[model samples]
Target chain A: MRVRVFADADWPQVWQIVHEVVRAQETFPYDPAMTDGQARDAWIEAPPGLTVVAVDRDRVVGTAKMGPNRSGPGAHVSTASFMVAAADRGRGVGTALLDFAVGWAKAEGYAAMQFNAVVETNRSAVELYRRHGFEVVGTVPRSFAHPTLGRVGLHVMYREF
Target chain B: MRVRVFADADWPQVWQIVHEVVRAQETFPYDPAMTDGQARDAWIEAPPGLTVVAVDRDRVVGTAKMGPNRSGPGAHVSTASFMVAAADRGRGVGTALLDFAVGWAKAEGYAAMQFNAVVETNRSAVELYRRHGFEVVGTVPRSFAHPTLGRVGLHVMYREF
Candidate 1:
């Protein structure tokens, strides 16, 4: 699989992945009823920020959006969110996307990268992040409502460049 | 002092307090050179979100803006930011504003209140929030750059209703 900057043509595939993930309501905190325009606005980063897609033989398999965590003093630190096609899980698509994001942030001169809310129940993603030098700096208890697990803690993951 | 919904007439006084607090670079992470329009956009909340001012006699001494910390599922948890006039420090203005914000969030049917970033070096504000039932759920180390203290942690303080 190869990762490249997201283009307008990738929206349909990206939206499909985002829709499934959001509707599952098991990981991300996005509104499940979000419309195409809303999702596009949320996923497509502009200018200093960026969004990328992972493709396998001409098919978009995963996507990631990244940018500064906050403006001003906090801008030195960056943040990112990722979503892999449900059917493409366990194929290292998420890993490839994360690797690209970390490299992009480092090239952009960020001092660190922080993920504000990683649902605790999403163990696979957490473990993946941990393996890639990220650590769970803190977890806000009972912040995320997992469909099956009820309310769960949201882990704030961090990694310094 | 009484707290009331912020009005257009209060902008001048409110801007003074916001300018001083933001310029200090000791508490909030706002841009030091933020324009009046940028500051106003950041300080004023509309509709579901609310911004209020603490009035002493006939002057605005403090201000706070609050609303959902994030959209959708995360919307259940509200958040707020407060600023008290520099000359009005230690006069319980901050406490009064906190009290009003907490009460307003509860009345708005929020499940809890979460402060995304509280500069750890800001002991007075930290202690005040603790006294008001906010606990540092997690602290992201070296996330904030204090003007004098150098790098500081940003605390994610939360209080469940």
Candidate 2:
């Protein structure tokens, strides 16, 4: 799969993945009932930030959005979120998306990459980040209300470039 | 001082405190050059979230804003920020504003209160939160570039209601 800057054409497939993950209510903190318009506005950020996708044979299988975690003084530290097609799991799509994001951040002069609100129950993602030099700097206990897990922790993961 | 719901009339005084703190470039992550309009838009939040003032004989000595830390599934957990007139420091205004915010969150049925970014170099604020039942759950190193200290950590503090 090749990673590239996201285009308007990727939204439909990207929204499909976002919808699935959000509706699952087991990972992200986004409202499950978020409309496509709302999702697009939040996911497709403007300059100083970026949204991208991973394509395999013209199929968009994963996407990532990253930018300064906060404006002004904290802008030097980057942050990102990822979504891989459920069918594409275990196929290295997430790794590709994250590796691209980290490289993009470093190239953009970021001091570090931080992931806020990573659901603790998502073992695969946690392990993926850990392998990518990320560490759980903090955990907000019972911050996320997972549909099946009752309540789960949300980890604030970080990795310095 | 009396803690009361904020009104449009309080903007001037509230802005005074916000402008001072933000311009200091030592505590909040907001852009120091932020305009009044931007500060108002960010500090004076809308419904499901609250912005209030601590009035001392008609003077707005401090302000507090509270709302869900994250939307949807994470809405049960609340978050708040405080700003007190610099001249009023060590006079108990911060504690009063924080106390009122915590009480309001409890009455609003929030399960917990989390501070996403508490500049570690701001010792007084951190100590204040600790006295009010908050604990540092995690710290992101060199997240804030202090004007004098070069770079400082950002602490994520948490307290359950």
- Top candidate, metric DockQ: 2
lDDT of 1 by residue, B1-161 (tens): 99999999999999999999888988887888898999999999997999999999999999999998876557788899999998898999999999999999999998899998899989999999999999998888888888888889999999998
Candidate 2 C-alpha error for residue A77, in Å: 0.5
- Runs off by more than 4 Å, candidate 1: none
Docking class of 2: high
Single out the weakest 10-residue window by summed lDDT for candidate 1 chain B.
B68-77
Clashing pairs in 1: none
Write model 1 residue lDDT over A18-137, tens digit each, in one string.
Answer: 999999898898999999999999999997899999999999999999999987767788999999999999999999999999999999999999999999889899999999999998
Over A20-117, each residue of candidate 2 has an lDDT whose tens digit, in order, gives: 88888887899999999999998997999999999999999989999999877888999999998889999999999999999999999999999989
Question: Between which residue pairs do clashes occur in model 2?
Answer: none
Each prediction's RMSD to truth: 1.3, 1.1
- How many pairs of residues collide in each model? 0, 0
Query: Please, what are the lDDT tens digits per residue for candidate 2 over residues B1-161?
Result: 99999999999999999999999988899989999999999999799999999999999999999999997789889999999898888999999989998998999999999999999989999999999999999999999999999879999999997
DockQ values of all predictions: 0.71, 0.85
